[model samples]
Target chain A: MTTPPTTVPSTDIEVRGLTKSFGGFLAVDDLSFRVEPGRITGFLGPNGSGKTTTLRMLLGLIRPTAGQGLIGGRRYAELPAPLTTVGAALEATNFHPGRSGRDHLRVLAGTHGIPDSRVDAMLELVGIPAAARKRAGGYSMGMRQRLGLAAALLGDPRVLILDEPSNGLDPEGIRWLRGLLRHLAGEGRTILVSSHLLGEVEQTVDDVVIIANGHLVRQGTIEQLHGDPATLVRAADPAHLAEALHGQGITAEPATEHGPGALRALTGDMVRIGDVALVAGVAVHELRPLRTDLERLFLELTEAPAHRNRNLTGDATPSTSTEEQA
Target chain B: MTALIRTELRKYATTRLAWGMALAMFLLGAIFSGGFGALYVYGSLTPDGTPVSEVVPPLVLARLVYTAGIQVAYLLALIIGVLSIGQEFRHKTISGTFLATPRRGRVVAAKVVALVVVGALNGVVHLLGCLLGGGVLLALSDLPVFPEPAELGRTLLLVLLVLALWALIGFGVGVLIPNQVAALSIAVAAAWIVEPLLGFGLTFLDGAEWLAKYFPSQATTATLDLFTGVDPEFARTLGGAEDPLAWWTAALVLLGYAAVMTVVGWLLTRSRDIA
Candidate 1:
């Protein structure tokens, strides 16, 4: 066996037209996305939205009904040293209850001729060295999560795919996990972590791929999802303000999310908007740049009517859904 | 392939189930051997100070004592085989197992090799238990402890083969039935109750007596009968086959069961999704 690389080689993840259907129920529907190297990409979806299924397919645990999930342009099963190339913690419960955590890691490690020292190091890395000798069946949810993470990192893999990794982590544990993920991503490793809550990973992830009902809702950098720079300007006379902004080649529309009579100008410059209002003889009450609340945007995108009805249509594509202004 | 086998062996070694099963097999084998040894020692003694060597030969009695526990050992071996794969599915560890190996065929093959080794180990432990208990009783009676060294060695080797084959059968059954509890219950129930009942039932059916010899339990007896030189009258009282098959034929039949189960199990597992 080749030696485990001290530094992870950068590998991007790509899913192209991947679909999985269990009997009549479609789990993941024509899903496609790309996760670049050296970035923490949050695979966000609601419960039962096929995040786990997609990850399993990626790891070759579950065969896709159509299409493929690739790491560094090769299928997971085809990798020469799969464990070294892609380390995955699909769930914390994928462990034998009777086996100790260290033995559990050793069993997996032995498959690739990985040394015992690496297993010990991984247990330490995941902060479970104290409990490594304990049976996994007795492990708490948080401990199991740590054990799962340890098993995933045992191969010192270049790519990490975790499914709902934060499910049982305490606040402090979550912080620790964030730090670990950041450090791994810093090494130019590709990290695809799935979670039902966008807020949980909003700060940690550089990019987000949001899906609902097995269809891609959106896939982009967090900044891109936030959209272009815009300002929320609430004017005393909204119609007059809109006409004034229209004359000046700036579009102003009612900002319903902010409340009635509030206008949203398609520009980020508050000073320029103030100048425009003054020139148009429009009195502005509230003028500030719109900071997108990703939490609310996540809820809106996943719960939208278009997405809810997406499975009903035959011609629906896997392309990103249009972001509706709230 | 070697790595996969090593991983499978480690998986077995790490679990308490393997050790526990081995202990259970040894204890059961010892108890059965002691019970058989006591019966033979008392039954052979006569007031005239002349042993009934013609009624039941000392060599045959010694062979019976040595192999007395194998009846239970083979069943235990089967259970071990079942649990090796069954436990993986029961605990959902199969997901991690597949993730580590990816090629399901290799994983199954490795498991097959590991379980066969485990079965042989179980056979060795069971043999030790039998030797410790039966050898003492035979020696106490002043009878030949190992009447025929060459024959006993061959019999012991076949006993190991029988056990390993039983375990492979269990592994196949475990694969066929992924639910640990269900597979264990069904397999044990069939082996312990259904098989014997069917064997006895076949005796009353005219011309069906020949088919009874193919039963796993009878096959086991027929296989051992080749070297044991068991008294036909005594064997008949214990529900032995009316017409025993050749030892090699019986061994082949047992091997056939193991092969069928493993192949079918592999086929089912090849494309089945882990989740």
Candidate 2:
């Protein structure tokens, strides 16, 4: 037999026209995205926007109804040893209650022929050595999540697919996890971290693949997607400011109302907002470009009525390519 | 495969349920053997109230071994089966299990092998307990000491067969029902109530004798036949079949049930989403 491919050199994950359905409902519809190696890739979406489904399909836990998800250049199931290729924490706490935390790791390690010494090392790595001997049934949700992480790290996997890893963590724990993911990515590991909370992923992830209602909405580096200052503007007397800007053929909507006269504007041109304010003889108290946060960017990209309607009425038909959506 | 099996055994061996089942088997065996030995000793006395030949200690020990092997030891096998598979789903540990070993078929196979090992260990423990308990009782009651090697060997073999069946049945229930309490309840109820009741009701029917022999408990009796030194008549009565199945035939039938159940469970496990 030919030797199996050991390393996925590109560290790039490319998914094309991946679709999955449950009964008659489309969970993921023509989803296409990529996660480049050496950077944290945030799989961002709303609560039911198919983020978890896409991740599960990527891990080969649930087969895609149509299309393909590739880690490197091959599907996840085709990998010789998946544990060593990809480490995942899909659900924070899926463990046998009767087993101690250390024993749980030991059993999982045995699957890939990993030794018991590695199990102890992982327990220490996740900082749960004290509770390692205690039965998993009595562990708190956070402790179980840690143990799950320890198991994921067993094979020294290059790709990490985590779903809401910070769900039940304290502030310190969340900080620790963020740092850990960053450290892993720094080692050239491809990390696909999913979270509905954009604020949490904003600083952690370097790139993003945003989905809404099971469809790809926006995907790029964090700087490219959210760092563009050309579309946002802030000013005083925002209502009059918007009206004057519209008169000048420059559309400006309310970003957020701050005080009596202060308001933020989400427009196609920040430069145009300043010019329109000057031409309309309106005093500009605060004329700065609005920095787009992930949450705001996500809402703007996904809240379009046309997109929402398409998602709601679309049939559960699977698509073979991303172009099918177009 | 050995590693997987060993891991599964470790998982079940550490549980309180395993300990409780073993304790129950030892106690039940001791009580039954002690009671029978006492009665036998009393009945052996002459009309003058002087004792003649006494019941052998090893014989009473063998009886205890047989009863516990059939009843208590077998029950532990069922418990092992249910806990092995059912606990994974019941405690939501299946996700971890699947994540670790994505090949679902291998995991199911490991559980079966583990079940067999557990059954064997329980049988050995029960036998030792019987021998020791019987020896103590005989010494206390001043009974004859005759430990027949053939009888002991037979009793041990019967215990192994019965325990194997119990584990197979328990595993089937665990895989089909995914809930520990529900699986245990169903296995216990079927062994105690449903099969026994159906067997009794079938005895009144004509031409159903052969069919009744296929019932789980009846099949267990047939499997247990390898252990006893009793005559063919005694074996026939215990099985309660007009034409009882051969020991090997009973083993095959039980194996067939286990094989089918395991395959079906594997299929379900493979196809269903772990969510």
lDDT of 2 by residue, A1-326 (tens): 01133334446788999999999989899988888988898888767788888887877778789999998787876777778888888776577777788887877777778888888888887788899999888988889788888888888888888888888888898888888887777777889989987778888988888888898888888888755343444454568777986787665665443334554454446577778878776777765555655565566666555345344564333322211110
Model 2 lDDT per residue over B154-208, tens place: 6567667678667877887888888689888888888788878888888788877
Clash statistics: count for each candidate: 0, 1
TM-score of each: 0.89, 0.81
Question: TM-score of chain A, model 1?
Answer: 0.81
**Poorly placed runs, candidate 2 (over 4 Å):** A1-10, A230-289, A300-326, B14-21, B31-65, B138-146, B226-243
Candidate 1: lDDT over CA atoms?
0.85
Q: Against the unseen true structure, what C-alpha lDDT does each candidate score?
A: 0.85, 0.72
**Per-candidate chain B TM:** 0.93, 0.81
DockQ (C-alpha based) per candidate is 0.82, 0.43
The A-chain TM-scores of all the candidates are 0.81, 0.76
Candidate 2, backbone clash total: 1
